[model samples]
Target: MTIWMRCFTGLQEVQKEQSDKLQDMKQFLAFIKKEFVHVIRDRRTLLILFGMPIMQILIFGFALSNEIKNSKIIIVDKADDVASRELISKIDASKYFEVSNERISESEIEPAFQKGKLKIVMVIPAQFNLDLHHSGVSQIQLIADASDPNTANLLVNYVSAIVKDYQSEISVPGIIPYRILPETRMLYNPQLKSAHNFVPGVMALVLMLVCVMMTAITIVREKETGTMEVLLVSPLRPWLVMVAKAVPYLVLSWVNVTTILILSVTVLNLPFNGSLLLLFAESTLFIITCLTLGIFISIMTNSQQVAMLISLMGMLLPTLLFSGFMFPLENMPEVLQWISNIIPARWYYVIVKDIMIKGLGFASLYKETLALVVITLFFFIISIKTFKQRLA
Candidate 1:
């Protein structure tokens, strides 16, 4: 062939190859579209696929932490002397304990403890200063309510550290030898049960995340795949559609919640001191709230992958970090604690812990319950508004 003929042949080959690649691209796009539609058609499978994994992650993260701090502490200064006052100052100065109140007698401790107003009571005996002056070694007793073992142990350690720091600063060769001894006394969970501290928080975080994140992605998958379009084009209103979508997962979540409780109480040997009916009621509300949130997410996002990724990043991370799941809220910076307030999971976690472990009733939990209700309502409103706009 001539040189021109050869160049012409090579150009034709390049054109044909480009055409083939374009055809291949079109086919791949069509395949992806078909798969997306098929997956979206069935809600149950979509929910299970996304929901189960997210639930497991939240549960694992929530259960992994046991740190406690910033517990409310009360001081009963019967001593009313210089040394006792100095010790009280030390307690106040410490980071872990927040001095909520002062009491004059041992009788006042129970009422404050019952009210959940105080976690630790420091008793500075009347002769505390005199003893320090005369005997060189003086003891201050730390009485902690062990109802929450983690808090109790934490309180004792905090008080000891404070007193020790005080002792170190004042210890001089010429000064009066004064040893501030910490006699740590605990009232409730003497051994500081790990199960009691972790179980309630775990149940709340895991169940809520699973129910909400799964339900949201499932709905989004249906929408992206064109199945949701067919459903919407039908006579069924959006509200009824949403309700129907939630019912199955609601039942499944309830079963999962029950299993979690049984395992926590029986296998983990955790205490279930609160009302079972109340716990169930709260759990149900939390699930509903989360499911509503999922629905909202679905209405906003277009693809199941985007929905799933958003939920994992937005919901799971905050639930783990701000819900006091992985880190104690007290240990977090003040800004983070404020940030925790916005997370629905945080309130639910506190509610579950108070109800299941602390045996607190509605009166005590009204604030947390109200907070979740408000958040659920907010998500519902935003989702409804967005969905309606999209439909129009």
Candidate 2:
């Protein structure tokens, strides 16, 4: 009787262990199925994971070719001699520069440079041919609008290369006389550090992206989750609610701006030669402008997904391309250049460069600052109207 009882208990114990193992296996399979469903159902997640990499590659890959072509230029040809004319002809022939105007007076250089009409303004010496004949080497000045310093450098290089080639062809190998000596004077970026060129661009990009994306996304999130209706029913006006939403991000943006400036100065050696107060003020206007734009986008779109796509495509791509972050505005085609003028970052970039590199104050920056204010007002008004419509 004792052996029978013991055998029955052992059999029951074995059955219980097998049952437990089977249950564990079933739970594991169910969890894996849930994970798979999540990965497949959330299309945005999948797109972000895969599409971003592909898009980044496509956008930046072709832009990697640094060849500057069809740059606008004007010549200050004081010498109409055969040598100077021939040199100008060679410069025009090169695919790099398309010469549109020629000035006889040297005083015209400042106005042309200030107007930013052309990239390179070559000033051929008055005695270009005579000097070459007398001293074997004649000097030519290439004043570049170095606001866009990278483009300026490329232009200088192309012109220098052409001059060197011309010299090699004209001069005897050992004698080395009758040479065109190119002297390049960069206006804005004297040191030619790419950091100086790109840091302002980075600031514009960061300010725009953070403020816009955060404001738009946060508002859309509340709408998506149905919390917006609760807020809408309260004492808060739609515009005020949007403002409230943006205020936190606005404060956070200043914090981020400070961090970026600090890092730029300490780590990247970015020059803050301009007033800190003015910089912060300009940055605030830009942030508010972006925030207004974001709220406007949120009002237009019902879902978080659409808002995100619109902001990414609308702000990010244009800011990167038209804002002269990677490619110089002058280097872009005429149509693109015209289009870039409307991009807020384009204006802000000039402001940033003027501040950080040129070390000019509100005196120089007033127009750009005014432009930002107008943009902010325009977007704010539009968003307010949109909110009113939504309430109606």
Candidate 3:
């Protein structure tokens, strides 16, 4: 009887332990379900977790490209002979060069460059065919705008290679009778220093991020923390409140621009050839444009997280892709090229390059300056409407 009682006690203890273990497992699963429900209910969280990755992959895959295509090139057929015509035909046939119909003369090249139209100008010297056939040597001049050094280098190389192929095809096998020499000239950046390209792009990226992201976050933080309503109820007008929010960021962004300029000149060995006054004025305009954009973003989004994500995903990608530093805008699809037109950073990048790298005057930059002004006014008007609505 005693042995049987002990066995029964042992069985009961095991059963009790098993019951406790099952209860714990159920609790764990219940907690997991509760957390899962919370995640699903928060749409923004779900979007960040799932939607952001998809968007990033798509953007990175499409926008992060370096293949050059359909770059505009002009051929000045000075020779107007069979060899020159044949060379022009070959260049036009290439997938890389889109032979422009702009009717460029040798004297008109500088003006065309100032207008930012032509990438390369190929000048076939007079009597190219006579020299090639009789003396076995002819020269082709390739003038490239080297403001964007990488593009200029690639273009020169492409033209040189094409000329070589043509020369080889027309040559006798053993005697090598035909020879064509490509004379390469880089216009703006003679040494082809990369700093000339990157400095301006970095300025655009830094200013856009600092002005837009910080301004949006500061305003959104007030709303998120429930202090914005308190301030709006105070003596200050709504527009004043918005202006007050934007002022500090504008000043700070200017400081950033100054710092970048100084560093570019001193550390990076970049030339500050344009007027300081002009550069400062342009920088201020660009900063205000970015600030207005940020305020507009703040007015649109309720939470700081959404504002941040939108600012980063929206502004950063466009800046990197359309600013024409990381990749050639010409290489991208036509739709993306059109989209680049709207990105404020693209204009700013061009302006900075003209001023700092090319030493161009306001005449060269007035169009870009006008673009920034238009963008600023656009965002400012919309932000005011939205802010007034919120106040009402």
Candidate 4:
């Protein structure tokens, strides 16, 4: 009887243990379902989780490109002979230049450049064929807008190669070798210093990320911690409160700009050719633009993660792609190029390059400056309006 009773107690304990294990599993599954429901309910979270990857893949595959093609070129056919026409035909046939039909004089080239019509201008000297056939040598002058040094170099190289190919085709085996000497002149950036290009781009990227990302994150963090309500309910006006939040970041961004300039000048040996006052003034304007953009973003989103993701995916990608820094804007599709105009960094990049690299004053930068002002005001107004709406 005692043995049978002990066996019954052991069996009961084993069944109890099994029931406890089963209960734990049910609780775990229920917790998992609760988490899934929570995630599904947050639409922004879902979008970030799924939409971000698709957006990144599409942008990387389509928008980001380095190859330069279909550059506009102008040719002055001073020697309108058969040989000159043949050379022009070859240049026009190449995939690089989209030759203009409008015949422009050599004197009109500078004005055409000022109007940003063409990338390269080729001046074919008079008696080009006569010089080539009789003396076995002729000179072709290639004037490239070296504002973008990399593209200018590549364009010059492409033209030089075309000229060489033409010379080889016309050469007779037994006779004097025909040679077309290409005299290349790089305008704006004579030295072709890489720093001249990279410095302005870095300025745009750094200022943009610092001012936009930091300001957005700071304000969104306040909202996340519920301190934003406290500040809003305080005696201060909401716009003033938001401005107060931006002030520290604005000052910090200014210091950052100053530091970037100092380092660029001292370390990179880049010339500070433009007026320091003008550069600083423009930098302040850009900083204000970025800060206002951040404020707008913060008002739109409640989560720090979403704000950060938006800033990185939205701001960083566009700045890198559209600012004409990592890739040539001319190489992108027309739609992408059109989209680039709305990006504040694009104008700032141009402004910095003009002032810092090209040594231009406010006279040369008024258009870009005006663009920044308009963008700043747009963001500033919208941010204020959104903040008021959200608070109400």
How does each model score on TM-score?
0.58, 0.57, 0.57, 0.57
- 1-392: candidate 2 lDDT, tens digit per residue: 99999999999999999998897666555534543454457677546434433333333333433557788888888888989999989989998889866554788777877876677888887889998878887999998988988789989988988998887777766675454655778776564556676667767777777678767887888899998899788654565567667766676567666766776677656678888888888888888889988998999998888998999999988998998867888888899999987688888888878887788999988888888788788878888887888878
What are the lDDT figures for the candidates, one per model?
0.75, 0.77, 0.79, 0.81
Model 2 C-alpha lDDT versus the unseen true structure: 0.77
lDDT of candidate model 3 versus the reference: 0.79
Highest TM-score: give the candidate number: 1
**How many clashes (backbone N, Cα, C below 3 Å) per candidate?**
1, 1, 0, 0
lDDT of 1 at 333: 88
Which regions of candidate 2 are displaced past 4 Å? 1-183
Task: Indicate whether candidate 2 or candidate 3 has the larger lDDT.
Answer: 3
* lDDT tens digits, residue span 335-381, model 3: 99998988999998898888887789998888898988988898888
State the lDDT of candidate 4 residue by residue for 29-85, as single tens digits. 553454345445767745643443334333433354334568899999899998999
Pick the winner on TM-score between candidates 1 and 4: 1
Indicate the residue-level lDDT of 243 in model 4.
70
